[model samples]
Target: MKQGVQGSPGKPVAARVPAQARPAADGGPYRERDASVRGEHTHEERPGAGQRATVQRSSVRGQILDALRTALATGELKPGEVHSAPVLGERFGVSATPVREAMQQLALEGAVEVVPNRGFRVVERGARELAELAEVRALLEVPVMLRLARTVPAERWTELRPLAEETVRAAAMGCPAGYAESDRAFHRELLALSGNEQLVRIADDLHRRAQWPPVRHGRADLVADAAEHMALLDALAVGDLDVVRGLMGEHFAGTG
Candidate 1:
């Protein structure tokens, strides 16, 4: 597994593992490319689902990775929090092998740290590290927002607004988990608008990392966040590049 940024309760840390950046489904050094052999897919092979069939195997690994990612992003696994293989295995309803395997992948991806005898721990980013990530986002994402401003499909916003609204409402209700998922969905949809898969993936990883910190207790405040999203939607309607860029920047910066 690739190593991610490491933070202590009292110290800031950032360590990234290279292999973690590869598709999570295929992250482990021992991963086989074929999903059927891995028992990740059970459907009988069809004639024309060639590529689709192969992709399905990767889907299990992806689901496992996503589950871990979501757990980390939502602060369910706080920075430096350690979870044993047996515990995680039981929770996920798999054997320790896959759980251990998944942790290794996360470690490679810079999401966790592994010790010789101790189990895996979720990585933590110190305030400074968090700021650095925000800077990176500001640099890479702001331009994408500009591109989106120029090219976004008029009808796409309609599809996006509801999700954003739902996110805001979830946050308002102090439903951190729901709100976080909605928030992720909101940005993922925005990235979809940009129509750049690579860019979207990078942005997603960054956004997921940003959400590592737990939300403060403020249901009313989250309600206000809904307003913030609505404001961005309005900017989208008018093609206000400046507002779009500004709001997105503020949104990410606030996460840190």
Candidate 2:
């Protein structure tokens, strides 16, 4: 049995009842026990509920990842945070399997590191490391923004205004999910302006990583960030390639 702190000490642990123990459609002894447990329901009792729960679980995983990312961004999930797979699994009411999977994904994205016996933990970035990464992103994206300025038509600028408005609203409201989505929308519009599909994909991957930090709603940080974005748009509007490049460099530097 997988041991985890399911509840308060000595509280009846979640019994690892097997699939075969679940009631066969006829409502046998299995159904009786399943029903007697107060407020406890299994996937077998409600067919669609299982699917719904699976969806909910997937959503929860996303939430967990968001939480993990926030912790890392804010330096909570630091070098010695003891981010054991089993402990995290227990906190999220999931088996270690999904936690391991999520950790592996994080590792692939440079968010976490896995040590042989210690499981996984956030990757600590030194000042120099962060500066270098920021420089790399700036080199890759600044020219892209300049290219967009030269290539994107006037009509496309108007088309992008709505998403920019949405981003401003999201940042103002301090809704993390809304902010994340709106931020994505704003960048996607920028990428679309470039008209290079490959550039769009690469830019998306880099942009998504910036959403890791948690922003307090209505905070000065968000307001300042939004103002910077507005500045970027204004520079783009003027077709000032050098200014746009500088703004993009600053924007990515802020992310790191």
Candidate 3:
């Protein structure tokens, strides 16, 4: 069984919100700044008319994809449920084209499957499939973590304290979507310290899929899982390889 951090709560750790999700300076909805060099150009120097339309369509598709993923993680889109692009487009105040494009991406990710002449059905994952995913994740991450435990400095691990605490707080809030996002943020940050972007991307994909299944456990189970983040950090900070190994093993096992 997985072990959790015991005893009373520690001092509050400041949460680190992702920059893209943070409120804008003017208090408007958070908008992703265009990173392309085109952003430096004036409206006159921007892309051609058709190119502009393409960019707008791509942005809409991306937004719909993010929203759909959130819905899947939160159980708003239940397993084995079928959702039509037209209906989803109406909900998002967009046309069916972008929604269909986004759902196609989800299909490629194995989160949903296309139904001929119908719609996409959220893939119903069984316990065995989830266990396989957990096993693969453990295989990929456990060794990387062990190597980092030996090489990364204690101060580096200390820097991640806020992210770990954020997971705990998100879990306590009882919102699976919030907890899922925070949980991924913590893991992604930790893996990124290895300076391997490809590894982080692959692990993130698996993590997102694991979150698609409805959370079968209650709030206490979530808190326990979240507590392991802090505990893992503690072990890493002290260079305790044995503790790190144990915690990582149980942590992935619990996800099965």
lDDT of each: 0.64, 0.59, 0.75
lDDT per residue for candidate 1 within 1-256, as digits (tens), equals 3232223552212222222222323333323334566677433445675565345435544555666665665565777667776556445543345457777887866778896676887777788978887788788777877777777765767667898888777876776656767877877887777778998889778766666665444677566666677777778867899898888777767762
Question: What digit string (tens of lDDT, one per residue) describes model 3 on residues 1-256?
Answer: 1111112243111122233332222323333334244464323223345454555666767877777776777666777878787666545555567678889999988899999987898899998988898999999999999999999999999999999999999889876777888888999999999999999999998887887775534788789999999999999999999999999998888772
Q: Is 2 or 3 the stronger prediction by TM-score? A: 3
Of candidate 3, the 10-residue stretch with the lowest lDDT total is 3-12
Which sequence of candidate numbers ranks them by TM-score, best first?
3, 2, 1
Off by over 4 Å in 1: 1-74, 90-94, 215-217
True-structure RMSD for candidate 2: 7.4
What TM-scores do the predictions have? 0.67, 0.67, 0.77
Give the clash count for model 2: 1
**Model 2 Cα lDDT, one tens digit per residue, 1-256:** 2332233454322333233322222222223234446675543335545555454445545655665554554434555344676676556544555456667777877766787887775565565665665676677667777877887766767767777777778777765556666776787778776668887776666655544433234446666666766777777877888788777776676661
Candidate 3 lDDT score at position 177: 72
